[model samples]
Each structure stands twice: as C-alpha cells, then as structure tokens.
Target chain A: MLSPEGREQIKYKARKFIFGSKDTEGVGKLAAVYLLLISIGFVYLYPVLYMISKSFMNLNDLLDTSINWIPSQMYLENYKQAFQSMDYWKTFRDSVVIAGIPTLINVVICAIVGYGFARYDFKGKKLCIGLLLFSFILPPQATMMPTYVFYTDIGLINSIKAFIVPAILGQGLKSQIFILIFFNFFRQIPKVLIEAAKIDGAGHFKIFRRIALPSAAPAILVVFLFSIVWYWNESYLTQLYVVGAFTSNAGGYHWSSLIVSLKNFENSYNTARSVAGSGMVDINESIEMAGTMLSILPLLIMYLVLQKQFVESVDRTGITGE
Target chain B: MKNGRKTKPGQLERRENAIGYLFILPWLIGILVLVLWPMVQSFGYSLNKIRLLPQGMAKLYVGFENYSQIFLKDPDFIMGLESYLLETLIAVPVIVAFSLIIAMLLNQKISCRGIFRMIFFLPIIIASGPVMQQLADQEAASIPMMNVTMIEQLLDEYLPHVLAVSITSVFSNMITLLWYSGVQILIFLAALQKIDTSLYEAAKMDGGSKWECFWKITLPTVKPMILLNVVYTVIFMSNNEQNALIVLIYDTMLSATGGYGYASAMAWLYSVIESAIVIFFAVLIMGRKDVYERRARKYQRELKREKRLEKKIRKRGERNERNYAKQKAKQQRKGANKKSA
Candidate 1:
C-alpha cells in the first residue's frame, strides 16, 4: 500500500545501513579488516607453521616439492632425534630454576625499591632515579668483562648463584624496567589511604605489607612474566656466567637452559649423530626445524594457556603511562 | 599518635627519609657494586693488555692501543659496525611504523580480536636466540613468496651497494621485524586506547574524514609514544641476541687472541655506537614539535623575552637617573660650601 516515493526512501535507508553512514561501520569495512587480519596473521605465523609442517615431514616428504604444507604422512622420527640431542629433560628443569628464581627475586626487590621511590620524600631521590635509568640505557657489554671477572673470583661461575646474587641485590635482567613499572603503578596509590593507615597505628612496614603490596598485583604479574621470559632466553649472559664457558674447568657442574643447549644444538646433534652409528639422515632443515619446534613446544603450550592474561595484561595494567 | 608534642617535625621527616633509604638500600648497593664499579673496571680493562696465567691474571696498561687496533687493523669490525648502524637505523622506523599501523588496525572494532592479538604477540615468548638462529638458517625468516632476488635486482640499479644491501637485508628480515613489534604493538594499542573517544566524535561532528581525524587528532596524542617506541625499538634491536656485533663481542671475549682487554674495547666501542643510534633517533623524534605547538612555544618565548627586555631597560633608566641625581646633589653641596667660605 506504500507510495512509490515511500518505497524509494525505504530502499535508500536500507542501502545506507548496509554500506555504512557517518556513525556505524559497514559490512565492507568489516570484511576488509577480517581479510587483512587473516593474511597478516598467516604471514606472522608463517615460520611457526612452516616449522610444524616441516617437522612432521620425513626425508622423502621434505625432498618432494609437491609436499609443500601437507606431508605425505605424519612423521615422528625428527622429534625423536631433536629430543635426544637437546637433553630435553635435564635442561628443561635447569631452565625452570634459572628463569623462575630470578623472576621471584626481581619482583620482590623491584617492588620495594619502586615503592620507596614512589612514596617517599627522600634526599637524592632524583639522582637515584637518574642512575636507575642510566643503567637501563647503558648496554651490558660495557660492564660484562669486569662483572665476569668478579663472578669467577667469587666462585659463582658455572652455578645458579651467579644469577641469584645479582637478582637478590635488585640487578636482575632488565630489573630497571620492572622497577619503573612498579614505580608508575605505586605512584597512583592515594596518599590519603596510607595516612589513614598510619592514623590506625599501622607502622610503615605494616602499612606497606598490608596495604601497598596487595594493590600491586598487575605490576607484579607483568614484572614476573617479562623477567622470566627474558631470563629464560638469555644465552649470552648465562653462557658467560652460569656455564663458565671460558674458564679452565668448564661444564664441571653442568648447568644450562634449553635455549642455551639449543644455541649449541648443531655440535650436540653432531656428537649424538656419531654416537647413533650413522643410521640417521644428515642434519637437514627439517631436523633443525624439529629441534626448534621442540625447544619452543613448552613455551607454546604456556602461551596457549596464558594467552588471555598475556593479551589483556597491557590494557589492564596501565603499563604504558602518559 | 600519643606523644607528638615532644618530637620535632624535622625528626619525623628524618625518620621517613631513613625508612625510604632503607627500602632502596638494596638497589643502591647493587647499582654501585655491580653496575657503576664494573663500568669503571671495564673501561680500565679496555685500556690494558690482559694475560691469563696458571695462577692468576696479569694486566699492563696499553692506553688507546686496543681501540686503535680495532679501528685500524680490523676491517671486519668496521664493516660489522657500519652494517649494525645501518640496519638498526632502517629497522627501527619500519618496526615502529608497522606496529603503529597494526595497533590502529587492532584498535578498530573487530570481532575475534583476542586471537589476532595472540598471534601478533606470539613472538615474544618463543623468539629466543637459538630459535631465531635456526629459523634464519632455514630461510624461514623471510616469506618464500617475497621474490627477494627480484627486489634486490630492482634496488641495486637505483641505490648504492651499501644502501641496497641494507635495504635488501631489511626486506629479508621482515618477519623477525614483525616479531619485534609485539611489545611495541601493545604499547601503541595502549596509547591508542587512551585517546578520548569524544575527540574523534567531535572531529566527526565537524565533518572530518577518518583520515583527517587520524592525522589531526590521533597522531598528536600519540606523538610522545612515537618517541618512546623509537627508543624502545632501538634498545631492543641493539640488545637482541641476533645482533651480530653482540655475538662477535661474546666470541672475542672467549677467543685466545682477543682476550678480555681487546674484547672490552670492542664492547665499549659497540656500546658507544649503540648509544649514538638511540640518541640520534631520540633527537629526531623529540625535536620535531608539532606546528601548532611550535608556534605556541615561540609565542610564549616572545612574550617572556619582551617582559625580560622591558625589565632590563627600566633597570638601566633607574640606574642613570640615580647617577645624575647624585651628581646634581654634589654640585649643589660644593656651591654651598664655597658661599659659606
């Protein structure tokens, strides 16, 4: 029963709704976003996908260009070789201890120092903060030699104590950044809250313990996560200090991480190859990819489990401040 | 709370300060001993001949000999340093821009956003040195479809060899660069999220297109973040385990001929170069004030300078008047004395 003009107006409104107007997004834009995300996401995960696909391909499948992504069949032999070569169990345990202990120490000490900086009227506070930033800026290379000598002299070489001591003293890997994160968070706590606590006869330490620490969960989580990841991946410092690579008696106690072991995987794999009596295929791209996949398998699982926390962390933590 | 009248405010402040110092004492000690002292000792080591013996170590001062030897005798070091500088310079911008773009894209209202974020951030977890080394070795770092050789040939014709090589290397390292952008993406996204939605709405009300709104509104608000991300990117690239110079330094430290002294020199030199890159980028970003901001600042300076100049002129006039008045008084006093005589 509608007139011709009314029908045309209705059609125009529907078209506008579909194609977008000034206020809301249209289907076209959404499609574009999805397309871009998928393509980039594919590219972003290309190496990982390639690693997985290649790891599952045996010698024949790897050699055949026709077997690009899908293998002719699933293969497990590459993983077996990589696992044996990496000493997966021992290094995994050591990696946990190495990355875990320092993270705990870094979290606690950084929080204390950061809280002090945030909630104090101390003299030379600016100088202290400046020095903290300066240390963050100065590359570790500038201080590597002397610190190495000091660690060797103290008999901390080739042991976990090398990392633990510095961490206990609040000089862990990227400790300055963690301290800054805590400082930024702690600065936001209202002074009135602390004053009220003081009025209730709570001493400074009591107030910090009962009040300040509980409110800094986000900062602590961030510091803990980043510290562990950095420490786990730190082959350079770990090699120099913990493994005693250059010392007269090296590899005495045999402390190492998975990534560190993986760093020298070729040599280890070659040794293991000789011991295996040459039945294995020559070390090729597939095996190397398999070894990498093995090395990252645990981390990938962790990422899967903690993906939500890791993604939302920056948003919820306010780590990026004005 | 009970006996506050007896204690001076100074005493309370002193106690508070003492507690603060106690809290920070651990860090202070660590920085002094582990950081500052070693920095000094490392500098000293860089200027000496360090010998490893059965009983202990020996050192003889060689001054700038180690540095000169590195610069003059070692072509590889110079080439490595040059390439490091070029790569870092080119890579930082590309990484920053790429992250900023992705952050904006993610900032848009999209479904299944969490999955995309996880994919982008996946690199932070598994990009250990060995893993990256293996991937790069397998030629998996570059996309197989990129046709890098074609790009290389295309670039080689128009650019110098050094630039062409670095550009090609940058292009080839595109994926690892993407990996480096994860933290930066988070940073940019955080910065982008912080932009007040009303600003965009107002721009829309003024008939501003999305592009205009972005350039006029979004860019200025996140400008500080650009500098921050640049510095962060520079630092990350320099400290990354994949950096050839760091590996070289590590190797030099362990080698028989290179030893501690020569290695320290290399480390120091490398650090200086790294710092220079950071500073260069920092200055580039920080020095570029917005046009409006620049004008406003210049206007403010002019006002301040005008006030200061007026004060200077007035002070000079007051001084001249006082001197003239003093001279007239002296002349009058001399004439009065003469008349009295």
Candidate 2:
C-alpha cells in the first residue's frame, strides 16, 4: 500500500492531467458554444455569400452543376448587363432622394412627437396613445387603396411627394415605432434636469433642442438607419404610386429601378422571348442574383461601416423596455 | 397654503399641456387626415360597388355584398386566411422561444460578442422582399449541407401528416426563420440585461440550481417582454407581403374585374381576422389575474397593518397626555390642603 503523501501526489497528477490545471472543462464549454455560434453565423451569411459568388458567374458557369462557391471564371458581363438594364446611376440617385428625405423628416418629427408624449400630461393623453397603438396595429394594406385614391386625387401620385408628404406629417412607414423609441428614451431623461432648465428660463423648444436631442443621439441614429432601410426596401408603396413614371426616358419599357427591376426583368425577359419565337424561357437566376446584390450593396456597405454604432444602438434605444 | 400649492402647479400644468399639444400637433393632423380619414373611406369603399370611368367614379351602395362573396364564393380567400392563421399560430411561439434562447446565449460572457450580434442583426438590414424572394427562388432558405429528404421521410413515417408537414416546413425554412429573429433577439437581450444580477446571486446562495433560478427569477422578470415580443412578431409576420392574406389582397386590388370595393372588403376582413388573432394571444398570455391579484392583496395587507399601527401609537400618546394632566391637578389640590391646615 502507498503512503498518504504518495496517494495525494497520484491524485494531484490525475487532476492535472484531466483539467490541465486551467479549467479545461470551461475551455471545452466555450469551444462548444463558439462552434455553435460560428455555424449559425455561417447559416445567416450563406445567402449573402451565395449572392456575391453567383453574381460574378457567367451563364455556362452558372449552369454547370459541378461548380459551387467559386465560379470557374469571373464574369463582368452580368454586372454590365444589370447596370445597363437597371439604369443604375439614375435609380441610385432616385433611391437616395426617395429614402433619404423621408428618413430625415421622420427622425425630426418622431422625436418631437415622442417628446410630447413622454414629457407632458394633457387631456386625452391616454386616448391619443391608444390611437397611436391602434394605428400601428392596423396594417397599411387596410387603408392602401383609399390613400392611393386620395393621393391620386390630390395629384401627388407619380412623384416623391407622395412619400415625403406623409413623412413630413409623421405618419410614414413604421414612424410610430420611431416615435415610441424616442418616447421611451426621452422618458428616461431625469426630470430634474428639465426642471433646472426651466428654472434657468429656457424655453421648451430650446430645452428640447439642447438637452433632449443631444442625449437621445443613439435612438435617433437607430431610427434614421431603420427608416432609410425601410424606405429603400419599400416596393409596395412605390409600385402603387410610381410604377412607370420614368419609362419614357429609360427605354420603351419601364425604368428598371433597383428592387422593381427584379420583377420587371422577369416580365421583360418573358415578353422578349415570346416575341422572339421561344414559348418556354427559363428565368436567368444568375442575372437575378446579380441585380439583388446590386440592390443591397449600398445597405451592406452602410451596415459594415456603421456596424459598431448599429449594435450599440440596440442597447441604447431601449426598445426592449429595459 | 394648500390652495396656493394647488393653483401654482395647476397653472404650470396647463402651460405644459399647451406646449405638449403644440409639439404633437403635426402628428394629430396626420392621424386625422392620413390614418383616420383613410380608414373611414375604406369602410365606405367596402360598402359600395365602385366603378371607374374616364372622367369620374361611380359608387353604388352594395350593403355587405362584397363580404358575402368573400365568405361564400372565394376559395382563395378562405385558403389564404386559413394558411395565414396557421402560419402565424406556429410561427409566433417558435419565434419568441427561438429568439429568447438566442438572446440568452448571446448574453453569455463570450468572446467576440459584438461580432455575433452584428452577424445576427445583418439580416434585418438587408432582408428586403426582393432579396428574400431571390433566396427562396434559389432554395437557399434551406440548409444546403444537410439532406432534408431523409429527415422528412422519417418524420412522415412517425408523425401524423399535418404535423409532419409543418415540422418539415419549419426545418426547411429554419435559416429564414432565424433571420427573422434578429431584431427579436436584440429586444430580448436588452430585457435580459435589465434583470438585476443580485437576484441570481441570491438564488445561487440559497442553493437553487440554474434551472430553478431561470424558472423562479428569469421567467417572471421577462414575462412582460415576452408579451411585447409576441405582439411585435404577430404584427410583423402578418404585415409581411409574403403572407397569404396580404398577397390575396394585393392580387384582388390588381385584378381588372375585382375593382376597389372587392379589394377593400378583402382588406377589411383580413384586418378583422388579424385583430382577432392578436386579441386572442393578448388575452391568453396577458389575461392571467393571479399574479396581479396576489400583489394587490399584499399591498392591501401592508396598508392595513400600517394604518393599525398608526392608530395604536396615536391612542397611547393621547391616554398618556390625559393621565399626566390629571396627576398634575391632584398634586396641586394636595399642596393647597396642606397650606390651609
């Protein structure tokens, strides 16, 4: 039989071997978690990677089933076709104008409205809040036609004003959410600060501009980014209002704007093929992918550049009511 | 003094109310002109048979004819409504549970946490309808590396047909669903951060296991956020253009024969059904009265005990004061008698 010291030494050696004296179990757990996260991340990123890869592939490479992940040859022709067909420069400008103006308007107006809701007590405040929530719950589709008609009657159709007008009025797409975010944010600002400003004889507007706006920078940024994205991706409203407005300048066909081009391309392809004597035309997936990539390229770049701010903004905006 | 305090604050409150109205005036106008007016007109449109002409529009009072047609004649409407509801019923719980789990994982003190958050949130930025459509067309929503057919076959053999189909659909579109959960996860993570760490520490010191801690502490604390997430998911998923009801409404609006009245009727019906679903879930999750009632009862008991204690102290003080006065009087009388003798 071994002495007590000898047995202790053996046990210590076994412990050292199993745990490496640095908590090998924790390392193992972390490794498993990271592995899971990385795989899920890859799954999240697959479509984007696929889009990027397939956008550069030629027709032959696209049709070749053996080829995956990377194209046999880098093809510039797809992008060239996409750019020409999409009226790339003009539509990009239009997209900026269409999405940018509304974002700016929504940020300012929503902040004001949210501040009002947050800081003030008034008659029928609950009723107003209930109405705001009701508006949010009511789908835009429920009122789309009437609004379309209203805009048409007012000669606002086929123009950016159709979008800008509502935005100016603080009723743009998901503006209620922005308002709520700002409301939540402004509510969290200590009342004592505002009271001090009041005692100093600062006007309400001055206090808001100086104190509230500066402090709610993160929420404002979040709302701005979200508004830009929503407006950029807004096909339904654009389709309802301005479908064929600029077709005369672009070509005999409708102007192939970024998002609308995807749908239009299929229709144009079908018609062209039918006119040229082919009854069955397989939709070209590669060109479609290329167009989609171009559409989201600006957004992806924006995300990459503002990634830190975007992530931090989620915490600061208090959307989860923390 | 009371009147002075009340009047001073009341004047300030009135002034503040005016400022508040001034700030919200634009939104109020927007609600009236853009939202409420449009809604009222939509109801009117649904009630009429609208005819478009070169110079003007004509409207004839149809009186619920459009609604009847939707229920009785339109197979597409029925099918779309059914599928939309079923999808929502399955998707809401799955989304809430999935996002909560992801949020918990992301909340862990892990390396490269910011990177993981960015990767998850990237989807919200680029998940436009066209891009999603392209992915769906390419079958990219499914896992490319796994053989789903074998799993589907196994599920089919073991489960009922409807159950198998729903499960398989969820499995195939698992990545897409995960993408949809990006914003939700962020919301949940924010809520999770609000949970005080001391509560967990206390639980652990009391020898509570991790699972018990989650049930007793985490779940209750995050219950309100869970309801918020459910509401958000329902509204978002149903509003999506990919939803069958929205698609049906869009198609009806564009159809040459359907006209504005029929489309309006369809939209109104869809909204009603959507509202019904929302109310049902709200009541199911938020209607429980036990937690609230218990808290109220506790508050009442505490208030009653405080009042009782206050009364007892006041009575004792009053009795002591009276006895001291009587003893002083008795001493004065004894002094007067001694002096006279």
Candidate 3:
C-alpha cells in the first residue's frame, strides 16, 4: 500500500539504524547517559538545593505552598540572625584552632610512624601494625568514657589539649587510617631509589626526608585534607568535652553550636507558645535553614575549591587497595 | 674476616632497628598511654559500679552484674541491639551494591563526569553531625516519592508481612541510605579505574559480549575492592553517632540514675557485636577463590620455568667455549714443538 518514495525512505532509514552510520547510535547513547546522570545528580543535590532555596525565602514565601524552588524576595535578615547567634568570626577562629593544630600534628606524626612501618623491619613490627589496625576498628564510643575519665584526671578536660596531646602522639581523629595511607604511599616508593640514595651515603633520616617524603607529596596532601575535614566535622567529642565550658553569651562556639542553637530556639518557642496559649512558634523556618546553611558553608566552600584535588587524592592514595 | 663482615651487617641491622623504633616512638607512646590503657580501663569499668561524687569517685566491684542487667532486665537495650544489627545486616549489602553501580556508571567515558561525581560526593563533605541532624529535623532527608501513601498502601495490600514492612521502611529512609554511599562510590571508582583497558579489548576480540566482559574481567578485578567496601561500610555505618546503640550508650551515660558501669557494659557489648558482624562479612565475602591470585601464581610459575631454561642454555654455551679453548691450546703447543725440531 506504500508509495514508491515512502518505501525508498523506509529502506534507507532501516539501513542507517542497522549499520549505525553517521554515528547516530553514539549520539543517542550519549543523550541517554546524560539524561540518566542529570536525573541522579538532581536527587543527590536536592537537600542542598532545598537548603539554599529555603534559606533565602522570607516567612511568607516559605509558607507559601506554591513557592518551591525560588523565593519571591531575597531575604538577608536570616543570614544576619544566624551570623549573630553563631558569633561567626570568633567561632570560625576557634574552629580553625581546634581543627587545624591537631591536623598538622597528626599528619607529621602519622607520616613518621607510617614511614617506619613501611621501610624498616624490626622486632614486634607485625604486632604494632596489628594494634594500629585494631585501634581503628574499635569504635571510639567504646573508649569514650574511660578517655573522658582519664582526661579529667589529668586536668586536660575542657581544653584543646585533649585533642592536641593525642594528635602529637599520633592517636588523633582517625590517625590510624592516616598512618595506613602514609604506609601505603611510602611502600610504593621505588626500592632502587632508596638503594641509590644509600650508596650515595644518605642515612635513614636523610633518605626519608629527601626521598620518601618528596615522593609521597600527593598522599600527604590527601591525608592532610582528610584529617582537616574529619577534625573539623568532629562534633561528638567536642560536645562531650567542651559543652560545659562555653555559654551562649560567652561567644565561644563549637561546630556543634548550630545544633545547640536550634535546640535552644525550639525550647524558647515552646515556652512562648505556652505563655501565649497558641500552637505557633515565632521562629521562622527560613531562619533555621539559614543557620544550617551557615554551619556547613565553610566546608562547602572548601570542597568546591579543592574538589579536583580531593577526587584525585582518592585515586592516588590507594586507599581502596588498587 | 668472615665473622667481621657478618658482625658489621648485624650491627647495621641493629642500628636500623633503633632508627625505626625512634621514628615510631610517638605512636608507641600514644598507643600505650591513650589506646591500651583506656581499653583496659574500659574493660575494668564494665565489671564495676562507678559513682561520681563531689569529693572523689567510688567504685564497687559488681562482678558482671552490669552485663546481667543488660541481658536479663533491660528491654530497651536488647531492642536497640536487635534493631542495630538488623539495620546493619540489611544496609551494608544494599549500600555496597548501590555504590558499585554508581561507581561503574561514573567510570564510563561520559560528559560532565566531574560534575556528577562532585554532586554525589558533596553530601559526605557537608553532612557533618550538626548539618545532618538539622536536615533530618527539617524533614529534608526524606524522599517525597517514597512518602506517597498510595505506594505504601499497595505494598501493604500485596506483599507478604515481613517483606512489605522491610521494603516500606527502606524506601521511607532511602535518602539517608543513599547519602551513606558517597565514600563507598569513591572507593569503588578508584578500584574500577585501576582495571586495565586491554583486558576488555582482548575479551571483545575473543567475541565476548559486554556482559561477559563485565562478569569475567571487571567483576573479578574489583572483587577485593568489593570486600573492602563491605568492611568499610559495616564499620562506618555502625560507628556513626546516629546508631541506635551509640545513642543508647549516650542516653544511659547522661541519665541521672544510670550508672557508669552499665553504660560501659553496654558499650563493650556493642563493640563485641560490631566485631562479630565485621568478622562475619569478611569471612563470607573473602572466602572465595581469588582469580587474580590464581593468575599471579600461574604467571610466576611460567617466569620461573623460563628463567631456568635460559640458565641451562647459558651453562651449555659456557661448556662449549671451554672445550674449544682447550683444543686450540693443544694445537698451538704442537705447532711450537714442530718449529723447535
């Protein structure tokens, strides 16, 4: 029943589809993949997008059922309140001190210990390595009480010494994993290079300093970033150790202060509701969202700037035992 | 002289040992003072009744009474343990498999791969304790798709009892579960990239399809990584602050009437269960015959055989040269004697 021109066109299209001429199949596949990626990317980014959008909405816009993605107006007051409540500048300084000092100490100590484990053979080395891994496997909660008691006994509680002392000794936040990373990196250094250095009269310290350390730069950076992030995000220990030391009025803040502030806001709202004989809380949702956003803003910026290196670090660290 | 040479290297070895110990001295001290001592103390604390006082601490030896209370008396403790174990058992495999799939997808040559990776990994960087808590408080961590009551109603009407409940619960918290997979995906991606492309090409040339290549080459190549991911996921999930067991321990510790001994006992019990789970997964996943190891052994054997054959050929050639030299020497001596005559 087809016309001659229509039959010719159908035959030509069939041939193109079967042979995949003109790279049509490739383009179609690429389009399909892009579609899949974007959809999943949207899912992964939904919470953060929600945070940002909700943080920018005013009370009326936030409560508006139709407004979802963007706000009617850009509200800056929420940021102002979050900043004031968090004592932004002072807390930022304290966070840097708390997360930074330990990171530096931890990296150096872990690198030295890892170098020893990797490059040298000594009595009980196997046992030491076993203990290192065992410590990592054991949950910190298991030892939390005793460590607390010990720190109190030594009068190191409520102070940064609690973090620094352990870091100096290479037992800081996930230091075992850092040591293992360094161990893997040091082990990958070419034996021939070390042999050549030895023949050139380089001693153990000199070889480690001038050869192994230089070659392990990528691993060092990776561990440094991981250590910093871990220490920065560590709230459980901070809450347990330093909560009593700082009051809201004192302007001293842990990274966990955001949670405390939210809790306080809820408590104050409940009290107000009871006093007013109403079910409403005065604090708006946008302000709370703004506080949450502010809390993670520094980390988000850090990740954005160092994302390439962070991703590359995972590939280079051999943490997955590649 | 032989003894002297041997003693010199022995001395050098001792020196090296000294240097190694020196390098690890800080870690050694840390292990002794921070890790080992606290672990011992934790064990001791679990067996006693500890009371904090205004003046000093009072400790009464309870002799496993605390442990008995947890098992024989406290329903909450047992329930927490059961739920924690069940969640871990279900979540570990699901998270691992999900991350593996995501990693495979990301590993493909595609446009905007970096942006995709960044989006997936961004949650891990920013989902610190406070941030995650805040998000959960705001109900932002829930999946709207899963929250549709119609699907739940259908599941309840059609599926069996346990399957229906488990599926519903998993879907309800799907967002949090997905968030947990960021680090696992990165690890798996690294493992995926380590696989050689030539193997895939060879498989293709042998007329193997993509599915066969994936099963025969890619899966086997990343098997060890799968085990690693399983272990990592187990430990990471179990140790998080949101875990039921950890929350229980914190609550018990903070309660006015709850004793430190009881909390310590709970913590120890949790640790034991965690170790058991880790060991179970490790044994189950790692007990298979490793294809890479078999290939490596075969390659080593072939190399040894080739080396032995080469050595034999060189030995025969050297013997032939010696024989020729002796014959030439005899001929030259005879010629010299003839000239003398």
Report clash pairs, candidate 1: none
RMSD of 3: 9.6
Better of 1 and 3 by DockQ: 1
DockQ of each two-chain model = 0.65, 0.57, 0.46
Rank list by DockQ: 1, 2, 3
lDDT of 1 by residue, B20-138 (tens): 99889999999999999999899899999898888877999999999999989988789888888899889999999999999999989888898899999999898878888888888
Off by over 4 Å in 2: A1-25, A244-257, A268-283, B1-9, B150-160, B288-341
Total clashes in model 1, counting residue pairs 3 or more apart in sequence or in different chains? 0
Share of real interface contacts recovered by each model?
A: 0.80, 0.73, 0.70
Tell me the tens digit of each residue's lDDT in model 3 across A211-256.
9998888988988888888877777776676543332324433343
**B121-228, model 3: which lDDT tens digit per residue?**
987787666677767777778775555566678888988765566666666667778888888898889989988888887877788876787778988888888887
| Per-residue alpha-carbon lDDT of candidate 1 for residues A31-145, written as tens digits (9 for 90 to 100) | 8878988888988999999899999999999789787899888889998888888888998898899999989999999999999999997889999999998888889988998
State TM-scores per candidate. 0.90, 0.85, 0.85
Residue A235 lDDT (model 3):
76
Stretches of candidate 1 exceeding 4 Å from the true structure = A1-19, A248-252, A278-281, B1-11, B298-341
- What is candidate 1's CA lDDT for residue B242? 95
